[model samples]
Target chain A: MRTVDPAKREAKRLQILAAAARCFARKGFGQTRTADICAEAGMSPGNLFYYFGSKQDIFAAVVEQDGVDTEALFAGLSAAEPWDALTRFFDLVVDLAADADYARLALEISAQAHRDERIAALVAANDRSVRSGLADLVARATGAGRIDPGLDPTTTATWLATLVDGLFNRVAVDAGFAPERERESLHLILARLLRHEAQPES
Target chain B: MRTVDPAKREAKRLQILAAAARCFARKGFGQTRTADICAEAGMSPGNLFYYFGSKQDIFAAVVEQDGVDTEALFAGLSAAEPWDALTRFFDLVVDLAADADYARLALEISAQAHRDERIAALVAANDRSVRSGLADLVARATGAGRIDPGLDPTTTATWLATLVDGLFNRVAVDAGFAPERERESLHLILARLLRHEAQPES
Candidate 1:
């Protein structure tokens, strides 16, 4: 019967999500339990249920949160120069791929997406959101003469998304692939792929 | 007490692996039962057990077969011109990615690799084999003046492998990404990435 503070409620929600993310990354969705999530979050089962109904619900919330984060990132980049924004986005990918938990969580979610229809829908929606964001940036860059005029923005964006997906895949499977060390090579590849005029360093 | 024909026995073992691949692709590793594999292979449980100890064993054999197939492919390409061999390799990739079953099976295997250490070891060994094969091709191309001298063969090969992994990922996630249609774009990207003098068409 007591009134819950809105800000505190949101903070508690995020805390639960962060803990669930770690549990999902370490044990995978099939193996992770709600009790484990509650344990990780240092919350009671009753408090955890106040935020999410079931393990499946919590998993769905995790995917939905990723979409929200990605949208927020694009919104922040919207005010920057188009080419710089695109490079900044790739740099962030390098950083995320460098994080072991984030990369493993990505793989876990993707693997679950194959078997769960709900997860697949969420993943596909997230993928579309990412591609559309890239397409908008590509269009802006092309209009500004920073990218090749001949390349279709949508197609270019899709290929760029493929590169991002590939980057994560490399981190998951290859032990020797260091995302930080490959940052320069990634930029060089991007410049070449987009046919940018100046050298990647310049 | 009866003597078994070794060639026939080997052929039957391959038959079971092929059937298991289909079952694993369709239902994923966790959901696929040994009984389902038997039904798919048109064999009794006893016959299936004669060749494999469990679903895990059959899955491992499928991964092992991929390594064998890859080694055979590189052996075939070794006699060709370096650039020509590389292009042929990419062409075959396009063909394989176009197959829904193969692409789905790849995802399944990769997903399983995350939870299973034995599978992880096999996948890692196979990945190393693939990268080494690519490095050899890149080295030959560099020595023949077909590739830029500034590019290190191993690094270049690693990125090229990344593209392959990315291609398969696109197939798994993007329903709109048609591998056959993207063949030309892939070639162009490769040309630009490798700094090949001639256009992809030439």
Candidate 2:
């Protein structure tokens, strides 16, 4: 038997996922074939099957990877000042919304989540993870007098998450949305929503 | 020769559309069969086909009817005081969002819009109609000094529409999100966004 390197195997798996993401984004999950993913990944069908048992498995992995990425992002932000961290979070959302492929993939996953119970569970878990992270930041900001103390942290966080969801949907729907151009309005809306008084330095 | 009464014909068409709406909302567009719609409408396949050429035509009509309903709604609200009309608009959104079937159907349509250019064009046209109505309200309010003069009506209207889109999405994704319960918060957020200082008449 040939010796298998775990790290190399993991890398190969990630390569497949990245390719799958592109294919799913371009064609949506139902229309995308595993062969398409293999071609995108520059691998044979056998090699692709060795990593993911089926297309469904590959799609699930893609959504699971989003949860992992979200957690990692929040963990990094948790150490920063709460207000700054929240600001950074919205800025990051704008960046993600600006990426057409990422926005389309997010919409595709959300659409699939509606029809598939397993996918819904995964999406709900990912949503919870995001909302929990946001709630923590909201709590910290309120406690530090950086935001309105009267606001419920969890509800505020959920709305914040909803705003990001809407942003992604706008990118997919509106041809002229221009996420980057809307950054100022987004910041202003956030400040108003949170009752934050911070002004950008001149 | 058999005669078709225009009024009766229109009524039957609406009945079919309403039934189709329920089926699409429950099973989504792809899974919903014309047989299911015919059964739901209490008609035979021949009767259903007489009204609609195919399932695709029926779906298109369903979406087009939504645009018609939306236009009629805005036309009714257009005469009200701008700010009051805007407030009523959000209130109606809460009502629609509270309807599980309506919210789900909206999501299904949006998902389909992503895959079909024709559907996308219809959805986009509906969206533009909505945003234009909202911008008109915003402009009137600004002129009347009911909202912040600094805010561009078109952009403000777009964000307001975005917020409502987010609201519908929240209902779909978050089982705990109660649209009726969130009314006050939504009002507060809108007031703050528009810099309106009006308080509810106590």
Candidate 3:
């Protein structure tokens, strides 16, 4: 009749999610079943069911894991100069794409988001949250007259988000593509795109 | 024995690819079996084997079917005005994303491309072709004094390609996301990024 500690319960849930992510990454969502998740978690089926109702629920939880708190990642970005803040965000994405398993899981979730409404909504919300944070940073930069004032913050934010996603796909598929090379290219592109200068002297 | 007509054989291969694309889109590559593809294509397993060696080969053939014909798609793009050509390219992508099944198939291929090297190489090659085509267009545009003369065409091409991929993800995931709306937003963002003069104050 002892009550379980809330912190202890939450910790267990996180442990389950971590294991589930590994299983999902190794074998895609369609191929990974609840039993596989249980085996990966080192727990019995009953114990795993006690935490998540079904395989899809476990998948939802795994996709929602706080792998990268995009908001928190960019929280202090505004303090830096606009160009610096933008490049920092790009570098963070490039670094994250280096983890092959994480990248695989991301690609799987993206594919699922197309068919599953709930998952799609969840991913869209996360995408908006990240874009809003970047938009705020862009707005601040524009206010400070660092970026072209004529640029729409939301549009620029979306453009930047797209750039990150594309880079992730490139990194995930191409083994030889170096993140350092992409980062340098991105810095130059962003500088030329945002600055009003007509011609950047090579 | 009479020889089969070459045109008829080629058409039959295309039919098989189309059916495989549908099956892969509906049931992912892993879940799909050779029998399933044969059934979908209304052919016997032996007949399917005559055309494709295995289920994986069928999947690869299906993916290869969607190969980006850069030469065909961008034939006159370099000769067009810079901003005009870029806008047309973006518009064409938006149009393509409107075909839900095609977009779904593309997403599925991208997801599976990571696990299969042949598929990965195929996807990468398509990416490179598109990037190269965009680079040529960007170079033409810059040389014609459309874009910033000093901007690197390759980098600009990469960013442009990234934007298209990101937009495709958005269209695929968001049920309420209209292709027109997404395309409009993209146009605005690209115009700003390319430093094209904004539509005169109205």
Candidate 4:
């Protein structure tokens, strides 16, 4: 029996997914070839195919990876104070936006979701994960009296989700937009929306 | 020599553009054909081609029309009280979001803007028009002491732009999301972000 190291195999898979993401972000699903992903990963086509069967397959993996990442993010956030966790969530997005490739990939995934059902479903699942995570935090915070008890958790979660989406959309549309610069204002908006307290920060 | 009536020509051009918007909204730019636009407009390919050399041409025209329409919207809002003008802008977006086709087309155009430079330029222009219009109103509002004097018009304008982008995104991701249902919350967010006075409405 041939021995395949599971850890090594998983690492290689992640390596390929990261490289594929960069290429997809730069070019787009329809325009990028499987060969292109191979070149990005510095692997032979056979090795790449050993893991991902086609370009579409690789694309699906990338989206699935995003869902996994979101799950992991909320996993970490789940343990923290709910209001702080919610604020920290925006901070994490600001960090993500600092990497233009990551930001652009988000836009690409959204664009591709409009065209492909599988991708759309994956995107929706990822979105649901985010909204539900935020909603959970909101419910916790509301119960703890850390924020406005009058705010509906589901609705508040939806708006927070919108701000996150809009943050990426801002990067996509405006070249002059710097997400890092907007962090202060983002925090202010959240404070007012969820905390009902004015954050007097410039 | 055949004489063409200028008013008739202009009206026909608008008719074609409206039909093309529907097709692009329904099928996206790449999937929609010039023939589709012509069929939707109830015109022959020759007639469509006479007005637009290609699908790309009509797409550009639709984007250009959006800019023109925005200019006309701001032209009317220019005379209103600045804070009210800003609030009405959100009202206008809520109305547009009520039409699924119109809202979907906005997302489609944004997605297409990612790949095509010509489309990107047009979309950028449209964003600039929106941001600048909002900025002008913010400036007037601040000067009139209707808003926080500390607020920078352009920055406030950008955040408002994000909200608008987020609104369209919410529609795209959540099937249960009704823009009409969101109108009150949108107003609440705006009031909190801009009005400086805490809006008692949840």
True contacts kept of each: 0.33, 0.27, 0.31, 0.34
- Give the clashing residue pairs of candidate 2, or none: none
Q: Candidate 3: where is the Cα deviation over 4 Å? A: A35-46, A66-68, A74-87, A195-202, B33-47, B75-86, B188-202
Better of 1 and 4 by lDDT: 1
Candidate 3 CAPRI classification by DockQ: acceptable
Query: Model 1, range A37-86, lDDT digits (tens) per residue?
Result: 99999999999999899999999999999999999999999999998999
Error of 1 at A143 (Å): 2.4
Candidate 4 residue A37 Cα shift, in angstroms, is: 2.3
Native contacts kept (model 3):
0.31
Note the Cα lDDT for every prediction shown.
0.85, 0.86, 0.74, 0.84
Per residue, candidate 3 scores C-alpha lDDT tens digits across A34-67 of 9888888899999888889999998888767642
Ranked by DockQ, the better of candidates 1 and 2 is 1
State residue A187's C-alpha deviation in candidate 2, in Å.
0.8
Q: For candidate 3, what is the interface RMSD? A: 6.8
The C-alpha stretches of model 4 lying farther than 4 A from their native spots are A1-3, A198-202, B143-145, B199-202
DockQ, each predicted model: 0.39, 0.34, 0.32, 0.38
Q: In candidate 1, what are the lDDT values of residues B1-202, reduced to their tens digit?
A: 8588999999999999999999988888878899999999999999899888988999999999988989999999999999788888999989988998888887777767777898888988888988999999999988887776777889889899888887887887787889999888877777767754422221
Positional deviation of residue A202's Cα in model 3 after best superposition, in angstroms: 23
lDDT of 2 by residue, B1-202 (tens): 7599989999999999999999988887778899999999999999999999998889889999999999998999988999899999999999999998898888778777777888888888888888999999999988888887878999998898888788877877777889999898777677767864422211
The reply for model 1, stretches above 4 Å from the true place, is A198-202, B198-202
